[model samples]
Each structure stands twice: as structure tokens, then as C-alpha cells.
Target: MKQRIAWITDSTAVVPDELREKYDIHVVPLDVIFEDGAYADGIQLSSSELYEKIDHSKTVPKTSQPAIGKFVELYEQLAEDYDCAIAIHLSSQLSGTYNTSKSAAAMSEFPVEFVDSQIVSYPITTLLLKGISLAEQGMDYREIAATLREEASKNENYIVIGKLSQLHKGGRLSNAQLIVGTLLQIKPIFCIRNGVVELFEKVRTEGKAFRRIMDQLDLARGIHKISQVEILHGNVMDKALELKETIKSKYQDIEVLVYPLSPVLGVHGGQGTIALTWTNEPKSS
Candidate 1:
């Protein structure tokens, strides 16, 4: 009999449900808490429901990583049937999920290989799906983890925010800064580096921000292999689809996925947030 590998990731990953089901991937959800109550992401709270609450709530919703106990419970269960499990999670710099996952792996009786994707949403989901494919092809856990780490190093996440108020309310930005930026209608463009958010540019108008993001994609197209592309949005599906069409017009061969940003992320990203992510083709000397 062939040994089975259990694939796992957090809810922050933007992998589609159908793919998750097909891959037999286990997703441990994070919590999105409102004044009324706390709800498990994707389980009790959906992106649409959570956004509706965000639209009307007096206070902004907060996100929390799953407890260590939850991970322990999952690892124990996976140990029952699978030979081992590989658990990939969001960046440690972005959240404590990677650390929490590591702690749980230590507590598990069976092997649970933990990885810090150093990226979020669609980029992380891309790595998870790739790893799952490798696992299904009979690759060992360590080999799959190593390959993903290498790929993640060459990946990029470019996010464009429609507003900075959510970042302020979430404490990612200071109130004064938010006021200044919003008063001026600033569209913030940022990228993830080494698992931390780094500002790439700040433009005055939405048009410039989108153009800048596309320019970066163009530059990436010049230098990388361009294996995958993802279009992520908080609530702006129309705009996301438009961007997808633009990308398709330029790069017709690459695999493209349109994913909705999770509610946990929407709390800080706010509505109209759109992100583009892709992995670079490995460079050869």
C-alpha cells in the first residue's frame, strides 16, 4: 500500500473550495471577531456576511489565529490515518500562525512538517496547491517543503488598497497618517517581503495605482518564468474580472485564478482591495 500524505493549510490561503476538496487538503480556520461574537472563518462567517457587518458595524472586526490546541487536535487526527502531514501557513511576520503551527507540530505524535509561506492569500495558496500536487505524485514531505520554500522566495504579492481607514482602525497605520492619506485620497501600493509588508509606492489616484501594479507585472514578465497568476479582491469582483481579462490579453498561457479575499483579510484590507500574485520562473546562470 502507498503511504498517504495529509495536506493542510490555514483559511487565509485563497485556494478554491473545489480544489481543496479534490486535493483532500485540511484547512484550519482563523477567527474573525466582531462586537457581537467571534466566528470561525469560512465556517460560520463568509466574505459576504462579514463584509456586510463591516459595512454597518460601529467597531472594526479583528482577526485571531487558531489556538495551539486546535492545531494539536488536527495533528492527532491526521496521525490516525495518514503517514505524515505537511502544514503550510501564512507568514510569521504577517501573523503568528506559522509559530502556532510549529508548536503544534512539536506536540503531534506523527510527523507534521511546518512551513512559513512568507506570503499570504493567493500566493500562499499557489504554493500549497503545488505542494499537494507533488505529494500526490509520491514526493516526500521534506522534498515538497524544500521546493515550496524555494519557490516562495521567488514569489511576489502586490496589493492595492482603496482606503487606508481600515489599516488605521486595525492599527496597521496611525490615525494621523490615515487621515492625511485619506484626506488626500491616497491609494497605497505595498508588497510582501520576507514575510513582512513593505510599501512599494503611494499614488494619488486609483488609476495610477492600477497602472503601477500592471507595470510591475510587465517587469516580472520580462524576467521570470511566470508559472501562475492570481487576481484577489475583497469585494470588487467586477474590477477583478476586468484585471483578469487584461492579464489574459497579455499572457495567454499562464494559469490564472480569480479568488475572493477571505473575510479575515477583508477586515484590514477593506472593500475594493485588489491584489495580484505570481511566482517567478527560476533563474539559471
Candidate 2:
């Protein structure tokens, strides 16, 4: 008998609307909690609304992965219709969403395949889209899982942080380091290395950071065949557009897409952060 497959992702994936509808991807939202209130990502609070609250509030907000109960409920429902489900989530190094989803998957009756994307934002979205495409082509669950794992190993993600204070308060960075960087007016660049965020370098300004990111992209393209490119930012569409144009100009054959970083990711990246993510195209036979 043929198997039916379903796709699941968290809110931070940043997938396009048309693709989501076409693939019938399910999104489980995270929670963003302020001192005065709590909101579900993409459900009760939008990126702009969350940023507005952050700008006005005296304190920074915190984010949490969807509760295990939410995942269990979703999987139970999906199992009712689909024979199995494939769940793609953010990096385990960046968030606990993967673990939560894994636990929920174990509890469900149907066979559910859980993938730790080892990357966040648009990179994660790109990875999931590849898996969804495979599924649409009638690939079985095991074959699809193998393809996703191979594709995920080629991902590279980098972030340009606009403010160190927010990241420090959010616990991603040390306070002492933030103070030292602030004293020197430094802008930090971070990259996902081995599924964890690692400091790549610190530049004197954001412009230099963007230049550094472009330089890295150029280097990677020289080494590998890039399949997709996504530029993500928080409340900075103009700069994102300019950067997108710069990338498009350089790689005329590939189209560069720009999107806002989801509010859950924005909470840690801060308001003005911009991230560049891409994956190598799979080799042809």
C-alpha cells in the first residue's frame, strides 16, 4: 500500500505563503513573553507588533518553543489523516523546539520523522522546502529523510547583530563581553558552526559586517554550487533589499529573496539584526 506523508514546521522557519499552501505545511508557533503579556508567534503577535512592543517596553522579551502538548495534539491530529509525518524544526543549539517535537513524536501513534535542521530562519525554511519537494515527487519517508539529512549538511548561516545589549540580556552572550564590545562600539558577526552559534568576528560598524558576510558568501559560492539564497532582517527592508540586489548582481543566475526574520528569532537577534543563509545544491548523478 502507498504511504501518505505530512510536513510540519515551527514558526521560525520563515516559509513563503504560496509554498506553505502548496505543500500543506503545518506551522506550530512559539511563545513570546513580555513582563506584562504573552503572545503566540504568527498567531497573536506579528513581527512588527512584537518589535513595537519591544521598542516601547522597558524590558526585553523572552521566547519559548511550543509546548510539548501542542506538538502532541498536532501529531495526533495529523496521524489521523496521514500515515506518517515529517517534522522539521530549528537548530537544537538555538532552541529546545526540536527536543519538544521529538518527545511529542514518540508519543504519537503514527511513525513521525523528526529532523533537527541545525540552522534557523530562512535556512531552515529552505531545508524544509527541499524535503517537501521530495515528498511531492512521491518519495517514501526513509528516502525523504535521507535526502534532508544530506542537504542539511551543506547549510551555512550568518547573522549581523545591530545591538549587543539585547542579545546579552537574552542570555545568548555574556554581559561582560557585551560591555566590552559596547565600550568599543563594535558590531558582532556570528555564524552557525556545527549547529551552534559561534562568534566569527567583530567589526567596527554594520556596513563592515555586511561586507564581511558578502565576502563569506563569495568564498562559499566559489567552493560549492549554491542552490538558494535568503536575506533576513528585522524592521529593515530597505537595507535587506539593497543587500538582496547586491547578491543578485553578483550571482545573476540565482534569485535572492528577502524576508523578515520571525518574531521568535528577532527576540534573540534584536530589532535591527540581519542574517544571510544558503545551501549547496545537491550533486547530480
**Most TM-score-accurate candidate:** 1
lDDT of each: 0.85, 0.84
TM-score of each: 0.94, 0.93
Native-referenced Cα lDDT, model 2: 0.84
lDDT of 2 by residue, 1-285 (tens): 667888999999887789889888899999999998779997899888988998887778988889999999998899888999888888888889999998888887668887888888777777787777787788898788877866777888789986787777667669789888888878889888778989899898788889999999988888778857888898899989999888888889777888998888888888888999888664464
Residue 32 in model 2: lDDT? 95
Query: Candidate 1 — which residues are off by over 4 angstroms?
Result: 171-176, 283-285
Predicted candidate 1 versus true structure: per-residue lDDT over 116-210, tens digit per residue: 88988877777887887787787888899888888778887799995576677667788789888878889989889998889899998787888
The list of candidate 2 runs beyond 4 A from truth reads: 168-183, 282-285
Structure candidate 2, residue pairs in collision? none
